[model samples]
Target: MNHLKLVFIILCSISLVTSCASERSDDDGIEPLNTSESYEELNISYGNDDEQVFDLYLPANRTADTKTIILVHGGGWTSGDKTDMTDFKNFIKDQMPSYAVVNINYRLADENNSPYPMQINDITSVINYLKNNEAHYTISNNLGLVGVSAGAHLSLLWSYGFDTENQVRMVCSIVGPTNFTDPAYLNNTNAVLQELLDTFGIDTATDFLEEVSPYHKATATSPPTILFYGGEDPLIPITQGTTMRDKLESLNVTHQFTLYPNEGHGWTGLNLLDTTLELKIFIETYL
Candidate 1:
């Protein structure tokens, strides 16, 4: 494995193994700490409830008027934990201290099953959970979502189509696949890559494929959006971002689309930091 992917895998694994640790305040759920003026309780629930649950983090200094940020972790929709994304959540919290951060975990897919409505359904439940206890968290009905890759796909779909609370004001997607029908996927040239992608082969089924495609479900009413993609994202072609950007413009939803022409599935140093900064600033414009 390449250096970065190896590191990402290690970090993700460490977070997952430690996910069940007793909850902590401002510490990765795996660690412990005394509550302070800036950090408070880290309320968590098994998003699966009857099964393995996930965790949630809310800032103590926030108020009901404060806009919250819901973050989704990406591992090809099959292997990620909310606690794994604690790094991203804490980064945002440190930058925008007042914004409450809600990270989530959803079901994964393997040989026997493809993760489908399972994760989306869990997303719906999380939204409901947040609203039911919104008063206690001091987060407002106004919310924003940020996701990377597979998580990006979920954030966009949930905000655009099934936001039951109608609370998602903005969403940011980083290197998320917009069109599953791309030639690279539909007419895949790499045999090994194709096999890995089509293992579940749901895209061959019409309604089923659309069932998970964010672009297929986008409408004029979708919330304002910001997108960032590296020009060389192998799983997601440049056409994906362009087509979506064109569609959003047609729908006239406030949106911004950015591309790092030299980058790929993920970004690095300066571009990464800049993209994150942009999200913070752009979210403020709407939230």
Candidate 2:
């Protein structure tokens, strides 16, 4: 009887400790999570960089034929992290429970590290990781990319500029800076123009800017894409999305564009819903 009592006491102690630790989040006066979605933290590095890490969000119920998507966060290729989009990723996972979404942190630019290669290299590493781990997730190699702001530019340029093997299946650019040569942007009398060029300048006489611009690199064979932008986005002029859509149309590439006359940078309510639905449809069609 003594031995049995000791064992019972030990088990009870463990249970209490577990319960206390589990309640830590709520100890700060928070409620329980309404929905449960499982996520895994992963470390990916090209070299010996300590900050090279990413997070992958997987639906709790694994899909038999899982689809994959890679998310690139926007900070003009100069700043940002994978965790910035957790809320959005959660929203997506709730809506489509069969897709595995990846949020990535790419190396940012400095004097030595130009945008020419680092951004695309980070994306390529992510694709390679997915391709290798497809079996683990039970997902197909069919992939898509979506980005906001600077992330939008990266998504478009990488999808259109990169070859199909490293390419995304479908791309959605949320107010992306597409055509650098647009009359609105090319002729904007604002400091934003100079700030953009100042970041990518090899010299005044170089064509490297064009090389990185999606509009300059677009081809008829580019993958299907959906683009969204506000009519009044100050950072990105109207011509950016419209001109790119024009090019895609002329080339017969599959594409769609949505413009909200009263929104900016981002959207809310119906416009946001419309954009999200369009993206859901686009990915469903491809992935």
Number of backbone collisions per candidate: 4, 0
Best by TM-score: 1
Error of 2 at 257 (Å): 0.5
Off by over 4 Å in 2: 1-39, 42-47, 60-64, 189-206
Over the stretch 157-230, how does candidate 2's per-residue lDDT look in tens digits?
Answer: 88888756844678888877776545554343534334434434443222654666788888888889899988
Residue 66 in candidate 2 has what lDDT? 62
Instruction: Quantify how close model 2 is to the true structure by its C-alpha RMSD in Å.
Output: 17.0
The deviation in Å at residue 16 for candidate 2 is 44
| True-structure lDDT of candidate 1 | 0.68
The CA lDDT at 218 in model 1 is: 86
Model 1 error, position 220 (Å): 0.8
Cα RMSD of all models vs. native, in order, equals 7.0, 17.0
Given candidate 1, what's the lDDT at residue 201?
38
